[model samples]
Target: MQKPEIQQLLDKSFSDFTTFIGSLSDHRFIVSPEGKWSAGQQLDHLIRSAKPVNKALSMPRFFLRWFGKPAKASRSFEEIRDVYRDRLQHGAVSTRPYIPPVTEIGQRETLLKQFDQQKSKMIGLVGNWDEPELDRYQLPHPLLGKLTTREVLYFTIYHNYHHLHTLQLREKPEQPWPTQLERVIF
Candidate 1:
């Protein structure tokens, strides 16, 4: 996606997620589903995940260049999504740094604010770069290795929705969630 489109999506996706998370009851927000993360933990995880990306984007171009450029062209959003999904299927999980601590109900509002700040900051940082610069620089993704800046944005956009889908499934167990790959709409 273009920079403007990516910024729009970054705004929309994080806004939707924080809105949903903010609406959760204290009990639901803190309670984990079996072995999965609680809603609050998910929120924390997202905040943790976005920090580095935001940091990377905020860096000087010379600093980012240290990571080098993509070996080939950037991948489409679908391709990145599919690769991520496949990795998850094969047992990939959050590395230690990204794992969130137990989140208390009292921390909900604070966490929500942090998420909003991170999202806003990220959107603003994205605005600093033009289209080709997005494809010209690279950053290391813990799970996906080095990705072009554009691909990083793509992954960030999809990652929000992926977590949103997971939270939705847990929130409404009685409702049948979509099962196929295409089900992760947006």
Candidate 2:
């Protein structure tokens, strides 16, 4: 996606996800099913994940260039999505830094505000770069290794959707819970 599209997706996806979380009851927001993340924790994880992306985007171009350019072309959104799915299938999980704490009902608004702040900061930073710059620089992804700035944006966009899907599933416990891979991938 171009920078404009990326910015729009970043806004819409996070907005939609945030709205959904806000709509949940206080109890549902904090409570998780067996071995699952509550809506609040999912929001927390998203905030954690976005921090580095925003940080990377906020860096001086010279700083980002330290990572070097992509050896191959940046992957398409679908490619990144597929690679992430495959990784999850093979037991990839959030590393320590990305894991969320036990979110409480009282902290719901605070977490939501943090999400808004991070999303807004990221969108603004994305506007500072031209299209080619997005493809020109690379950032380190914990699970995906080095990705072009554009690829990281793609991943960030999908990452929000992934967690949104997971939260959606949590809304319907009567339906059989999706397996770990299915939860995020499908």
Which residue segments of model 1 deviate by more than 4 Å? 173-186
lDDT of 1 by residue, 44-125 (tens): 9999999999999999999987898689999999999999999999999999999999999889989999999999999999
Worst 10 residues of 2 by lDDT: 173-182
Candidate 1 local distance difference test against the native: 0.89
Top-TM-score candidate index: 1
Candidate 2 lDDT over 46-132, as tens digits, reads 999999999998888999878987898878999999999898889999999999999988898899999999999999999999988
TM-scores of all predicted structures: 0.92, 0.91
Model 2, global lDDT: 0.89
